[model samples]
Target: MIVIVDYGAGNLTSVQRAVSYLGYESLITNEPEKIVNAERIIFPGVGAAGSAMEEMKARGIDDALEKAFKSGIPMLGICVGCQIIMDGSEENDAVCLGLIKGTARAFPSGMKEENGILLKVPHMGWNGLNVVQPHPLFNGVGKEDEFYFVHSYFPEPLDRNNVFGVTEYGVEFVSAVGLKNLFATQFHLEKSGKPGLLILKNFCIWEP
Candidate 1:
């Protein structure tokens, strides 16, 4: 069973629905034992980074997640959920889980103006991803494959090789990251249509 963490995240239902569509059983819950004991964990979130971290901490989920992740379970994070897997975020002054050594910060303000693309904040739309590592998370997809996105900020890891896939806005940046058992994406595979499902399906079927 795949456990989708629910701490008042807006996109939880859509994610759960998509998972069900793929024929896998899933649960959306904040219960620590259920999450820690699941076959896999999907950390999906939306909204302010600091507030989300506070919610995780308040529920003692922060500790539960750390325990679960360290136990070698397959784990994936989406959007701000991805950010938390890293060190922390420049957004909302939040101290993240730091499982992946990096920081999530805002896109450069002037890049769009200088690059000739009238970019929008929050980058809410379908975007193309460039595969850097041929992994199961991006199984059945290619560098040209596009996925759904809904965030303005992106992850900037100190080690660039940790990036498994990338997406472009005014400039290209890491779209998804894979390091050991921890997989994360700045784009929402749950909302990316067919290509997205392929990715999630791969995750669902991945072995621990």
Candidate 2:
């Protein structure tokens, strides 16, 4: 069964609904055993990194996820879920899952557009990805397709090769990352409409 992990972060229901809409059944649970046994896992969240990590640890979900990853199960992360998979996050000065060798960084202050308009933090809107490398999660996804984003911090992998896609919001930032069995996106595929659904569908059937 596909498992949507719940570690007390928000946005669980929406991710569940998106999977259901794609004709795949999923369970939302905080149970680490369920997560470790899940055929596929979706770790999606919207909240502060510190509390999210705290909850996961308190429930032992953190160790379970690490075990699942090592078992070679296909896994996907979204938003804060994507962020905390890195080594650490500037969001709450919190150490993260370290699933990927990277850190999440806040968008620099005083970011501006070419037209001199100051860009907003929490970059809440639509943006297209400049896909740097092809991966199954992006099968059939194209250059023109835009995804929904809502974040102030972005993942920066220590190894540039881990970066799958990028998006510009004053500065270019890593928007998608992949390493072996794990893949994640900074944008919320659940909220990105058809294009987003396409990625979710791809993940549901992806082998790696």
Candidate 3:
């Protein structure tokens, strides 16, 4: 069975429902033992970085996540779930799992705004994605397809090779990533409808 890490974050029911739409068996759990035994893991989150990390750490979800990732289980992190994989996030001033060598920082202010004002904070809604490289997680998705995004910060990988896909706001940011067996995306596939289900299904069938 697939496991959705539940440390009190993200749209758990929507994610579970999306998994069901793909005809997969999944359970949302925070227990370490249950996570360890799961065939695949989905880490989803919708909230601020510091509080989310605190919640995970308070419940020992951080340690459990570390173990699950090291075990090489197929894991997918969405939004805040994706941010925690990096070394740190500027918004929180707190450290993260450091699974990947990168940092997530706030959106840059639009140049046209003389006061260095942001184009928009919490960049919500749909945007197109460009497949920077082939990734198992995006098996059935496409470059022309638009995915739902509702995030204020985006990851900037030090090593360009780590970025699997790119998306633009007022600036370009890494939208998809692959670090070894771990995969993550800034988009909400659960809310993407049919295309989203295809991505989830691909992740389930992907051997890695």
The TM-score values for the models, in the order shown, are: 0.95, 0.99, 0.93
How close to the true structure is residue 200 of candidate 2, measured as C-alpha lDDT? 96
Worst 10 residues of 1 by lDDT: 109-118
| Tens-digit lDDT string for candidate 1 (106-192) | 877756746586777878888788887788777688666788888877788889878888877887878888778888999888888
Writing each residue's lDDT as its tens digit, candidate 2 over 83-157 gives 999999998899999999989999999999999999999899999999999999999998899999999999999
Cα lDDT over the full model 2: 0.95
Q: Arrange candidates by lDDT, highest first: which order? A: 2, 1, 3
Candidate 3 overall Cα lDDT vs. reference? 0.83
- Candidate 3 per-residue lDDT over residues 19-70, each given as its tens digit: 9878899998888788877889999889888888888888888888788888
Clashing pairs in 3: none
Model 1 residue 165 distance off true place after TM-score fit, in angstroms: 0.8
Model 1 ranges with Cα > 4 A deviation: 113-117
Clashing pairs in 2: none
lDDT of each: 0.84, 0.95, 0.83
What's each prediction's clash count? 0, 0, 0
Better of 2 and 3 by TM-score: 2
- Candidate 1 vs candidate 2: the lDDT winner is 2
Model 2 regions more than 4 Å off = none
Model 1 accuracy (lDDT, Cα): 0.84
